[model samples]
Target: MHLIKSNWKIALGVIPALLIYCIFSIIPIFISFYYSFMSWNGFSAMQYVGLANFKAILNDSVFWLSVRNNLIVVAASVFGQIPIALVLALLLNQKIKGAKFFRTIAFLPVVISTVVISLTWRLIFNVEQGLLNNLLDNLGLSALAQNWLGNPDYAMYAIAVVIIWQFVGLYFIIFLSALQTVPRDILEAADLDGATEWQKTRYVTLPSIWGVIIIAVILCISGSLKTFDLIYVMTGGGPANSTEVMATYMYTETFQGLRYGYGSAISVLIFVFSIVMIILANVLLKKRGNRKPV
Candidate 1:
């Protein structure tokens, strides 16, 4: 109480931002929650439907397929992006030639607009006159060339690869920043004790950034759950709904299908899924962190 009173000026300065956040973010969550219990098209009166929307979702096979695809995305981001990013960060942390140029090139996708990336990749994946198929033909591996986005079996995996390529750079920068914060003195001491490079990385370097890694995992999971723009632009959740995710499905249901209340319910499910996954990740990571070194 005394601390807040002493810092009243800071509190006053924070109030406006807090109010803005409440109006835009916090308030809408409650509004969505209320709307989830009703059924309404945008033009019609809202009818109180209780759990009808959620009940329908339970029996909806398409929604379940979206859920499965979302889980695949989360798995790919966590398992593929994090390790690849960490390895890149480690390699770049060393005194390597053209490290800065390589870093910039890797991060270029992150800064590029998603629409542009999607369009470009879509072209590369095109069945006719696409770079991938052309390369395969030139290399005498024409049989390996695929329909990519047009084929249901390959569509989701192809999207997953692009997702990894785009976001790996972001986590790479994050891990590199965390790596720089590790104490050099400890590393020097480890060197004095004749520690090999791998040993030092396993013990000192990774432990220093373990918390950041956990946060990255949580971010990856959250981002994967709500992934829409890139996949939407590339496939529009088509190829027989193979690439559909929760957010894209929700968009279709609410806007195109005119099931606003049902969309709200889907949004609520996304929120719940994010919260649960993050909590599970934290619990699992905490347990790993607490384990005694063998």
Candidate 2:
């Protein structure tokens, strides 16, 4: 009773936020789980369909295609974007003139709204009057000038490039902050030991910032998995759904196809995939951390 009384103010302070979270986040997730087991058209009535929605999703080809595209995005984000961000961060972390200006320019894309970025890239990628094709034509590289966002073979890659370009700044800032946290003493020690620049980075800088790298990887995975807005604005999963991802696929199923139950199942799968990937990443990183150095 004494403990409860002492914490009453804290409880009261938390109630509003707790209530909002339950109402906006928890309840919708529960509702989606319930709806996943039923056939609903968003109109007349929901019919209890048992595992029918799951069955349908299992056999969905386009759904699998979307999953493949999502995996591609995840790969590009973690492998392509994060490494480049790390390099930029390392360079910018040095005691160089105009470092702050370079950092600001690098992070500028992260502050821009995704919708605006998508629209800007869309114009740049336009085949005829756009900047890229015009540059190619002027350089006598007309053969390389093709419809970047329209060709099925290249559309997904094009979108992936835009995604990487737009968000590398975010991870760069994150890595830069991490790099700044590294102990200057350790770097000095490494220099005294005659460690080459590469040796210093590989042994001191990277290992010191491993935790931040892991967090960046997790962010890349989660963000890539749930990516929707940019793809929607840019491609709408177009050119025969070549650029489709899980979020866009779910939206298409629910709103466009009116397959509410199926879409709910897709949502549930997205939640599960995200959870599994996060867990696996944590486990792998933990194991790596626990390993004794040679």
Candidate 3:
């Protein structure tokens, strides 16, 4: 009772925010959860079916393919996007000329509309006369020119590159923010100790921003699971479902195929997978942080 009275002001201040959260997030989540047990074609009456949809999803080959693609995208984001972003952040964190300008330029892609990038890359990857193929042909590398979107083997990878290019700037910004907080004293001490640049970075810089790394890993995992727009615009999960992430597959099932229950099952699976990854990442990060030099 005493604690509640003491914190009443703060609780009162949070009331509006709590209300907004309830309206926007909580309500919709509950609705989705409720709809998950039903079969509905958007405008039609919903038919409640217990775990049938989930069972069906478990047996779905294309669904599994979508899951596989999502995992691949997540792996690429974790390994490729973040490492490149960290490298860029490290470069920008140094006392280089026009570092701020370079940071802004790198981040410009993130702010640019995904639809625009999708359309632009779609043209670049065009089989007939796209710039990529055209350049390759001009340089006498015509043999390297192949159908990027039309081919099943290369389609997912191509989309993954686009995804990476589009969001690398976001991660770059995250890394830059973390890099900015590294203690100058530690760095100066390392320099005074005759530590090589790589040695200083490996020992000092990486340790300081571990929290950011963990957050980036979580974002990568969740973003990969929920990716929709760019892939929606680029391939529509096409080329024989080769590029079908769970998001795309779920969208197709719910809206196109009129399988709301099944779509919900996919969403649930994605939610579960994301939760598992986040928990695992947290464990790993905590262990790494504990093992850091005291």
Candidate 4:
């Protein structure tokens, strides 16, 4: 009590930011929760529809497709981005020429505007005269080139590839920083014990950065669930809605379709799904972490 009283000025300093967060972030969440139970077209008086919106979502094939596509994004991010980033981080962590330059180049995409990245990639993915197709043609791989973003069969996968490419540097920087924090003395001890690089990495380095890896996985899942801007720009959830995810679906249904309540319900489900997936990931990773090494 005395300690807190002594720090009262600090508490006073934090109160305004906390208030702002509650107003903009926390309060809106509860508002969405309330709106999820009521039917509203944004202009009309909200009608209390109970669970009808959720019921509709369950039977809505489009919503389910969005969920599936969202999961694919999550899977691609978690599996593709993290591993690639870790590998790159590991490689770059070593003493190499122009390492800083390389890191800067790798991380450039993360700092660029999402809309710009999407627009650039859209040009590259263009059916008529895209850079990718042109390159494939030059390599005598014209058969490999198809309508990259125009075809539904390949659109989502193509977006997934872009997602992986854009974010790998973010995690790469994260892992690189985490790698720097691993104790040099511990690594030296392993070296003295004649441990192979693979053995040392597996037993020492990875275990030390395991917490960061778990956090990265959770971030990837949450971010993937809320993916909108890139796909919205690149494909606009199109090529017959092949690239639609929960966030895009929510935006279209709410603002475009004007089914505010249904959109709220979708938003609520997105929140629930994010929480559930993060919890499940933590549990699974914890179990794996706890298993005795054979």
Pick the TM-score winner: 4
Point out the higher-scoring one by lDDT: 2 or 4: 4
Clashes of each: 0, 0, 0, 0
Q: What is each predicted model's overall lDDT from 0 to 1?
A: 0.94, 0.92, 0.89, 0.95
Please give, for residues 137-250, the per-residue lDDT of candidate 3 as tens digits.
999999999999999999999999998888899999999999989999999999999999999988999988988899998898888888999999999999899999898998
Residues 1-294 of candidate 4 have per-residue lDDT tens digits of 989886997889999999999999899889999999999998979899999999999999999999999999999999999999999999999999999999999899999999999999999999888999999999999999989999999999999999999999999999999999999999999999999999889989988898999999999999999999999999999878888999999999999999999999999999999999999999998788766655
- Kindly report which residue pairs in candidate 2 clash with one another: none
Residue pairs whose backbone atoms clash in candidate 1: none
Considering every candidate listed, which one attains the maximal lDDT?
4
**What C-alpha root-mean-square deviation, in Å, does candidate 3 show against the real structure?**
2.5
Task: Report each candidate's C-alpha RMSD, comma-separated, in the order given.
Answer: 1.7, 2.2, 2.5, 1.4
Q: Write the per-residue lDDT of candidate 1 for residues 1-294, one digit (tens) a residue.
A: 988886998889999999999999899889989999999999989999999999999999999999999999999999999999999999999999999999998788889999999999999999998899999999999999999999999999999999999899999999999999999999999999999999999899988899999999999999999899999999999989999999999999999999999999999999999999999999999889877655
Candidate 4 weakest ten by summed lDDT: 285-294
| Stretches of model 1 off by over 4 angstroms after superposition | 1-6
lDDT of 4: 0.95
List residue ranges in candidate 2 displaced over 4 A.
Answer: 1-15, 291-294
Positional deviation of residue 241's Cα in model 4 after best superposition, in angstroms: 1.3
